[model samples]
Target: MPHVTFIEHNGTAHTVEAVIGKSLMEAAVDNSVPGIDADCGGACACATCHVFVAPEWEAKTGTRNEAEVAMLNFAAEVKPNSRLSCQIEITAAHDGLVVHMPDGQH
Candidate 1:
């Protein structure tokens, strides 16, 4: 399992052991981490799973796909590193990955 840390807008951090092959959104929900609503159930159809990939982890996390890019268009407080958590699958290489939630989500 990879250890992923989720940071909230208020500066709180939730570090959880994430399972391989599962989406980051699922890990957050399973671990009861705050800030990731995942309203679309990892379908990539909604922006409730929005997160900002820490700059250092951006390359490892990779770029957003078309669907994610489209969905993020409707998200709030979007940034260059913004990504839909549901689109981010967990892997060993992602250990110690850190993601931050926006101040608000639409």
Candidate 2:
């Protein structure tokens, strides 16, 4: 399992062990990390799972696919590092990954 840290908009951090091959959205939801609603159930159809990938982890997390890019347009406070968590599958390289939530999910 990879350990991921999810930081809330208010600066709280929740570190959780994430299963390999699962999506980050699933990990957050399973661990009860705040701010990741995953409204589309990891289908990449919604932006409720939006997160800002830390600069250091960006390369490892990879670029967003077209569907995720499209969905993020509906998110609030979108930034260059923004990603739909459902699109980021957990991998061994993702250990210690950190993501920040926006003030709110749109």
In order of appearance, the predictions have TM-scores of 0.97, 0.98
Off by over 4 Å in 1: none
Give lDDT tens digits, candidate 2, residues 28-72. Answer: 999999899988898988799999999999999999999888888
What is the C-alpha local distance difference test score of candidate 1? Answer: 0.92
Candidate 1, 1-106: lDDT as tens digits = 7999999999999999999999999999999997888887989998998999999999999999999999999887889999999998898999999999998767
Go through the candidates in order and give the clash count of each: 0, 0
Give model 1's TM-score versus the native structure.
0.97
Q: Can you tell me which runs of candidate 2 are displaced by over 4 Å?
A: none
Clashes of 1: 0
lDDT of each: 0.92, 0.93
Best by TM-score: 2
